[model samples]
Target: MQIVEDDIRVDELCTRREYARWLVRLNSLLERNPKHRIVPTISLSGSLAVAFDDISVDDPDFVYIQALAEAGIIPSKLSSTSLFSVTPEDGSFYFNPDRYLSRKDMINWRAQLEYAILPGTKEQMSRIRADYMDVKDISSDTSPEFFADMLTGEKSIIRKVFGQSRRFQPNKPSTKAQAAVTLTSGRMAEAVQHELLRMEAESSSRQAAAEEIKSELLVRGDIKNFWNEKLLVERNRGVEVQKLYIATLQDLDKEKNLQAQNLTENMKEKAAMDCQRHLILTLREEIEETSERLASERATYVAEQCNIQELRKAALMDQEGILDSKSILEAEVEALRILRTWVEDEAKKSQARAKVLEEVGRRWKWDNQA
Candidate 1:
């Protein structure tokens, strides 16, 4: 089952028909080598069938095949087959398995492989023509140049599987030896990649476990600190509670002593108030008696004043009568004074008559003696 030639150069080129034949040979070589069990991402048989269907049903080919079949230039069996049964499931029947593979076919194979390996929902062949595809080196979308740039990009399936290359000539044909070497190289690269991914996954798991263990240890320390703080709080609370209990007992005893003192003072005050009440009642009664006595004495004094006023009026009338009698006595005294003055004149006349009679007796004695 020797598949690749020792003299197959990397730059050797062939036609699309020739490349298909080589691809079939590569798949056969991979199958016979049981030691390398790498599964191809794309089925070589399916890709060939699709190519055969395209060539058969295309406008020119269909017209040519119809013309040939109707004129009896070609077999009629192809007309009935009509590229209809070339489904993904039954494609191997149309294309000869030993046909040579073209660069276009290689692009299809690599793109399918990328679709299988990479992460995306859109199919790889469709993405090759999508506007977002960065294969700027490609000359035309309809030509084989487009797939050449797609397969030769930095992260392309061919670059990943077969290592980096300066160019991917999609129009160039592929030899059987070249196809075998590319397939073998791709399988080995995938194996090595799988191994590296497994090792990296294990390393990441170990790092995550270490981080988790560190986090648990930190949590344990925090728990210990929380309990220590809780113990201190409980101790302080106990001390405060004991102090509060003692203070409450002292306050209760003080309250009891104050209540007993208040009761004694209340009884003493009640007795004093009762005695004062009795004294006030006695004073009120005495005041009533004194008021009655004063009223009676005032009436008696009023009667005595009336009697004194009558005596004063009688004395004034008697003094007036005595004054009239004294005036009559003074008039009688004046009449007696006039009668005494007349008697004094008669005494003087009697004295003179005596003197005359004494003179006559002296003369008669003289006449008798002669």
Candidate 2:
């Protein structure tokens, strides 16, 4: 990960955002699709070679490597999670989604993660295979009409979710909207918080100590980095929880592609249109639970936005106060300058008076002596 480390300072503490990004990269490597292509790395002159849109030396594996000539960090400053903190007490590794950040001894972290995830992935695949094994049998023995009926039954539930999402998606401030984002956008608390901090720090009072610190942190890209990490952590948590289902979904996709070959043109078009709603996983607990969660999260988001507006208003008031203080300090400085000038004028007059008396005394002594 020293791709960016050559000129970056090692002693620089990782900002929360940087830490959060680190967590995602590390988790993405260990917990994501096993076959997801890792970004390629190239070395030249004992440093990472320049490249465009590829690779990060900040990755956990390479960040602490002693052989690289990049800026580094105190490895212990980071908090620990599953792979970093694993103990083979009973000989099985624990998977706590705790800190997800750091620990000192990281030489074998990848080994620890492999040890933890290997058995879980195998078990999950076995269960998924067992569940899907009957699909071919069910299709082969069924008549055409019976098979069509089965597809219709399952497709209707999917249609309901797809239709509902379509209905609500337009109501959102939808000049532009991403398909995967509509549902996840319901969790808007973090976005609201980001707006609040951004507004407050955009123009902070220089004389106000707290505001100065805020501005400095904002300038250094520290403030937003912290919040971004928190959001990434939440996203990664959801991703980790759903990790096992990824393999199942991959198998399901293959079956779907095979089944699609038999469909007519119109039916295929309809199927393609509904695929956008795949993110709306409203099964198991039913649609109502998803709706309720969305509503609750949306309400929380609105409340936070209101709070941000209030905070910005308060910040404006503080800025006004700082301006008033600036005017008062300026007036006091003018008065001090005037007083100093008057004192200098009086000292010059006293010096002139002393010189006159000295001249008079010297003349009187010369006349008495004559």
Show pairs that collide, candidate 2: 1-57, 1-58, 2-57, 3-57, 10-72, 17-225, 78-102, 79-102
Per-residue lDDT over 33-69 for candidate 1, one digit per residue giving the tens place of the 0 to 100 score: 4422222323222322223344464533333223323
lDDT, candidate 2, 157-263, per-residue tens: 21222332322221122111121121112112244355557667764543477877889999999989998999899899989868858978998999888777756
lDDT for residue 207 in candidate 2, whole number 0-100: 41
Q: Quick one: RMSD of model 1?
A: 38.8
Q: Where does candidate 1 have its weakest 10-residue lDDT segment?
A: 36-45
Clashes of each: 12, 8
Clashes of 1: 12
Q: Please give the CA lDDT of all the candidate structures.
A: 0.52, 0.42
